[model samples]
Target: MKIGIISDIHGNSEAINSVLKNIKEVDEFICLGDIVGYGADPNYCIEKIKDIKCRCIGGNHDFAVAGKVNINYFNYAARSAILWTSLPLKKENLNFLSNLKRRIELEDNVFAVHGSPQDPLLEYILDKDTASFIFSKFNFKICFVGHSHLAGCFSFSENNNQVNYMNFSNGGCIEINTNKRYIINCGSVGQPRDGNPKASYGIYDLKNKAVNIYRVSYPINLTKSKIINAGLPRSLADRLSYGR
Candidate 1:
């Protein structure tokens, strides 16, 4: 099965639409969350994701927007987006966000989480030490997470018991070795922070045990204008071009 993986959409409908248009033939979509925060068009983005039949989990921002968590923990830019999302999310969308799970185990022994395996909404598995720590907790062959908004992979080779990291720039397939375990970050669809302005996502071909990291250009200015017009923080809009 070819599954499209997306995360941290952050309400940028334009970026989401561009990604959907670029990757048209995936069998299923797995979303890692932040469906309604950090940008404009919360309801529109939620409706679009539903229309595409995506399987998703709750993100930290989603939790804050649902009032399940306090937004005071968020940074200034995120707080602005969370407040905006809380105000405009339709009742149905709010219910959807509230019902989302923190993590999901795929049929092929792969796991998905918004942040990290240990704490789905709180921790970030950015370093090899953290990745190695997480590897000990789960028996799955692979764990896919998004929250850092960076497209990268951390693999623990059972042979050497070593962890290694690789960043993917262009979209391509990667074959998974059964002998080793992997923790893959599919990256952000709406907001990328690895110093790349383009939106990022990934495709996992379960049959072949391969993953492809994809990036697509979208109308950043349009999203920025919407963010500003929605009364959200201007920094939220300004950061899109810089990918910070």
Candidate 2:
């Protein structure tokens, strides 16, 4: 089962469209969430994902737009985006976001969540201890997560009882080892903060037992212009280029 895993789309249809073009062969599509948030075209992104019936969990932004979460939890800019995003969304899309699960566990024991499984919609597993804690919480060997907008993988070695974290900033991959456990972050599509500025996503190859992180250079300016045109913060437009 070749799975196309995408996350943190943040309403950038340009990025989503570009990313989808690169992975058309995958048998299944799994979206780790944030289908709408900090860019333009929220409705399009939502409709696009629904068109494919993407297996997606609810992201913080998604919940915020659906009024399931308080905007107080987000920064002012994000809160503004969410508030603005809510205004134009169709009732069906709002219901769609509302129906999204906080976490999804595939039959093969693959877990997908907007954040870490421990806190599904909020925790940022950025260090070893966090990773260790999350790995301990889930019995599954591999879990795919979004939310920090950083593309990377965390590996736990039972022999040493240690967990290590590294970024796939340069677009690297891991040859999945069944004897070990993994926490893979699929990064952000709409807004990438890995310092590379490229759109990031992942591929999970079930037959070969491997996970690959891939990057594509989308039209950042187009998204930037859209953000600016929509009256979103300039900082939001600026960050897309810096990937900070």
**Tens-digit lDDT string for candidate 1 (1-244):** 7999999998999999999999967999989988889888899989998998888899999999999878888998888778878887789999999999998878767889998988999898889999989888877788999989988999988999999988764445567997889999878999899888899989888878799998899999999999898888988899999987
lDDT of 2 by residue, 96-117 (tens): 9999988887557778988888
Count of clashes in candidate 2: 0
Shift of residue 177 alpha carbon in model 2, Å: 0.9
Scored by CA lDDT, what does every candidate get?
Answer: 0.88, 0.89
